[model samples]
Structures are given as C-alpha cells and as structure tokens.
Target: MARLLVTPATGALPVTAGGMTLSLTDPGCITSLAPWRGAGMALSKALRAAHGVDFPDPGRISTSGTTRCLWAGRDQAFLVGPAPDSAALADHAALTDQSDAWAVMRLDGPGARDVLARLTPLDLRAQVFEPGHTARTLLGQMNAVLSRDAANGYEIMVFRSMTATALHELTEAMKSVTAQGGADPSPG
Candidate 1:
C-alpha cells in the first residue's frame, strides 16, 4: 500500500504579456507563527536555532539560505520556506499550517511592476518597495501578502479560496499594462 499526494489542482498558470511574465508559484511548506505574551525574543532565538532564519522586523523579511521569514503583521511572522516542521515553532509560539491555505504567484520580467501597479494600492516602485520589503495589501478585492523579491520580481499570496478571482484580476490587469506597452495581449 502507498500513501497519497494531492495538490491544490491549480494546474500550471503562466501568463506572458509584453516583457512580463506572471506565473503561479509553488511555495513549499508554509508555516504561520505568532508569539504569545511578548515572548518574541525567545521565539526568534528558537526559530534561529531551528531554521537558521532571523525573525524579521515589521514590514521586512529575513532570509537565511532557503528559509525566509516574512513579517505578516505586528508581533507575527509567516515562515515561508522548505522543510515544514510544526515543532520548529510550536513550543515557542502558536503555529498554523498555511501550506494549503494560500495561492502564491510571482510576477517577474520587465513589466512586472507595471502590472502590479494597476492592481495593488501600495507603491510597487523600486525605492519605496525595494527587495526585502513586505506588506499586506489589497489585490483587487482580496487581501494579499505583497513582497518584493527583487527589482524585477514580486510575490503575491492570497487566500486559496480566492485564487480564481485573484488570478483573474491580476491577469486582466497585466493584459492592460502589457497591451499599452505594445506587447502582445495576454491569452484570454
């Protein structure tokens, strides 16, 4: 007998418009961590020992090798990386398995920022939202975690239940931006 493996069934979604590419991202093993009773220092040290990642400050992200800790909000950080382990954070703080609860995507290439600018309220510019910066913002009607992965790359995470709607809105926005840039219109 063999165990089973099931994915979210989102299939492979990659949209190319002009010089931009929007691709569904595979975020392996996402874990949410929230400290209780102001034990952030203790929790941070524990996480450092477990994943070699320094807990990030608010609006910031800390990455050590493959592991990344994104600031989810005040006193809370989302540990997005490989090798998911509940006990890695359970003792130090509250833990939630968010691996299947999010629909992650990346917008990269030349016109990535232009597409993002059309959908999100936050400034997606280089100086203001540079790499290592993270924020919770509105992506159309859905709440999304927006992170600047690089000057030309950005990551967006929205609730799994809102995946279709979010993708639709993002694709549409990308099309508009790319079309104006004289790139071929995105696929319908």
Candidate 2:
C-alpha cells in the first residue's frame, strides 16, 4: 500500500512574469453560508458574533482580522479564512465546508489589472472596482470569484480542478500585457 500527500493547487509557489506575480494563498478554511428564507438577518448576526464580519452586499467583500465574508451570489456568501462556529450558524443558514473545493490565488504587481483584463469582462479600473469589491465573473472560460483585495492586487478563486487552466490563462495574459509595453504606471 502507498500513502498519498496533499498538494496545493499551484504547487504552492509563485509564478512571475513582467513584474507581476501569482501565488497560491491558503485562506485557512472556506465555508459556504447560505441563509434560509427570512433568516438573512439572523445569519448576519450569527456571522458577526462568530467572525466579527458583516454579511457582504452584492459585489462587496467584508473583512475582520483574517476572516473575509464575500458575497458569492444571491442569498449566498462564502466565509474565507478561519473555521466558523457551525452550531451558532446552523439555525440561520446552511453551512458546508468548501475548503477543498477551491483554489485561491493572489495576483499582484504593477500590471496585475491589465493581466486580468485579458480574462474577465468586468471593469478593473480602481475607481470602479476599488479594494474590497468582489464579483462572480469569468476568468477566461472558467467561473471565478474575483476580488480587488488591495491596490494593484487581486484575489482569484476558481474550482480546484480548474487551477491549471486558470494558471495558463493568467500567464498568457501576463505575457501579453508585458509585450504591450506593460501596464500604465499611473494610479487610477
């Protein structure tokens, strides 16, 4: 009999091109929290009590300490980082462990937005997609959760099975952005 070991989606290493870098990020734990009908408020309260994070509005990401509550879609949010108090949340919402279902990656550096622009249709301009803004969007052909976690930085989450494809797409975009004289150095 042989034993197996778990591995990160991107080999747990950084990939760089044209001054930009992409790396795997361990968010600790990811839990899907879907509120039951009419229990939205209670779920929010329970989340606050458990993680100190408010339920996020559509297209927003809320954070407290290392925990982030991101609006995943209508009536659904994902709590990334730290395990939630399931007992406290069970009455208000359905809780499912999603830690192994996703591959979280961090993209950063000067031309990061430009690199992402090649893959997604959403506007990446800072004025429009400021830090803490998040969206359910397409990254190339895969479904992804995109968030502007900081200026010149983004957090991209996709299905664990699609990580290789995601990496290929982003790398190609990074190369293209680099070839096209690189990203504009101005802050927008």
Candidate 3:
C-alpha cells in the first residue's frame, strides 16, 4: 500500500503582497473544551492551574505563553498551542481533539484590518475589537473564528474544507487594500 502523506490545509508557504502576509499556522494541539453544565468556574480554575490560561468569557482570548484558550461559543473554548493535559481537564470539561478539523491562518501587516474590513462585516476598529478580542463571524461567506492577536495581526480559523475559499477571499481583499495605497480608516 502506498503511504499517505499529511499536507497542511492550505499550502505551507505564505502569500504576501504589499506588506500584508497570510500564512498557514500550526497552532499545535487544538482541543475543544466544553464545561459541564454548572462547571464553568471549576473548569476555569483547573484550566488556569494546568495550562496557565483562564477559560475565556465570551469574545475573549486568554493566553499564557504560547497557550491560548479562545472563547469558541457560549460555553466552549478552544485550547490551542499545546497538548492539553486531558487528565487534568477531563473532570471539569468535555475535551475533544480538534487538531485536524480546522485550518489556522495568520494575517499581519499595517493593512491587515483594512483587508479584513473588506471581507467581514464585524467592526475591526481597534477601539471596538482590540488585541486579545475574538469573534465568531463571517469571513466572506464562510464562518470563521477571528482573533486580534496584536495591534496589526489576526488569527483566523475556518473549517478545513473552506481553506481555499478563505484564502481567495483574503487574498482578494489584501490586493484591493494594497491597490488603494493601504489606507486604514479604523482608529488605533
């Protein structure tokens, strides 16, 4: 039998143009952690002890080192960037491996928000969606988890099957922003 090789959801190389760069990112192990009903506080404590990150509240992203707990929905968060100690977290939340179910991409540059503004309806203005904030929103027509990881950087997660579409939309937006001389209207 021929061996099957694993490939990244998108290509491994970054696509860059006019100072904006979009690159596929490996966020280590991605675990979906849903706290048992009424176990939210306990889960947050246990997570902080085990991973040094709090189970985030809605629209937040908690971080400690490279590990992050991103609020994924009303009662769920994604434990990303390290292999979670399942034994430590199993008691408080339902832990499911989501390592291969999604594609992770990083968009960074001065024109990043401008590019994103062209694609998403959500306000990317720094005052409204500052660094460390996250949202479950539409990226073009696809559902995506968008996080502002830095002043001019974002991490976008989408279903693995939508990788190409996401890339195409983002690339087109980036091109348009670049063509417009990188004008950004969102206040810092």
Candidate 4:
C-alpha cells in the first residue's frame, strides 16, 4: 500500500489596498514546552543545560544561527528549529504540539510599518523595534505576536481564523500610506 501524503494549504493571501502582502507558510510545526514548572528561578539554567542555550525571556532572545527560541508566555516557550524532536524535550517538560493551531504570516515591503501601526498600538520605529526582537501585540483588535524579521519585514503570528482579516487590514493600511506619498505632487 502506498502511503498518502497530505499537505496543508500554504500560499499568499490576496494583496489589499496598501500593497501589504500576507504570505503563509506550512503550518509551522510547533512544539510547546513548559519550562518553569519546577524552579522558576533556574528555568534558564535548566534550559541551557538541556538545550545548550539560555531561555530568552519574552522579547529578549535573539536568533543567533540555525535555531531560534521565542518566549511564548511566562512559563511557555516556542522553539523554531528544524523539525523539533518534541519527544526529546518532553523528557524534561510537558510538550504540546501546536503545529496546526497557529499560522505564520510574513509581512514585507516599504509600507510595512505604516500598515502595522494602524492595527497595533506598539511603537514600531526602527530604533525602537529593532531586528531580531519579538513582541506579543494586538493586530486589528486581535491578539497576536509580531516579530521583527528584518528592516522592512515582520513575521506575524495569529490564530488560523484571523488570518484573512489580518491580511485585509494590512493590505489596506499599506495602500493608504502609499497613496499619501504619491499624492503629493511636489517632490522634497
């Protein structure tokens, strides 16, 4: 018998008014583990001992090389790496598979910030929201996390259902900003 391979739909949603593009990836395999159940103070120490790196507190850990860790919550952390061996990490803490529960969307282009600003209250100034930093913020009234992927790109995390709305809002925002610049006849 041939084994059947099922793949989830992964593609870019339609562009909105602002030229903001929302591209979706394979429902990134997520392995959630609770690391602070025991000695909260030593969670980082324990994580380092087990994973070879310190557990980054929310918005602190930087993506160094192949693997990057994000603090998903106070006691929870999400590891972004080559297909995770959740079983290996389960030996130390409770591991939950969240691959299908969340969606990763990449927002890029010049007007990225303007589009995001319209939805989020967080200050996204380059000097403020530098690269490699991540923050859990609301997007268009929906709770989601945004990561600064690059100088002009952001990786947004939102529930599967809100993907459509989020994309729409971002696109509209990007278009509005673009229009403002081009509407000005005089070039500075």
Each model's lDDT comes to 0.79, 0.88, 0.88, 0.65
How do the residues 82-164 of candidate 4 rate in per-residue lDDT, one tens digit apiece? 45554445555676666656677787766677778779999888777878778888998888878887777888887766666
Best-fitting candidate, measured by TM-score? 2
What's the CA RMSD of model 3 in angstroms?
A: 2.8
Query: TM-score for every candidate vs. truth?
Result: 0.88, 0.93, 0.92, 0.76
lDDT of 1: 0.79
lDDT of candidate 3 over 148-174, digit per residue (tens):
989989999998888888888998898
lDDT of 2 by residue, 39-92 (tens): 999999989998999889999988998999999999999998888898999999
Q: Residue 64 in candidate 4 has what lDDT? A: 41
- TM-score for candidate 3: 0.92
| Candidates 1 and 4, the one with greater lDDT | 1
The better candidate by lDDT, 2 or 4, is 2
- Model 1 regions more than 4 Å off: 1-9, 182-188
**Candidate 1 displacement at residue 58 in angstroms:** 0.7
Model 1 TM-score, 2 decimals: 0.88
lDDT of 1 by residue, 17-109 (tens): 777777887777788888877778888988888888877988899898878999998788888877546676676788877887788888887
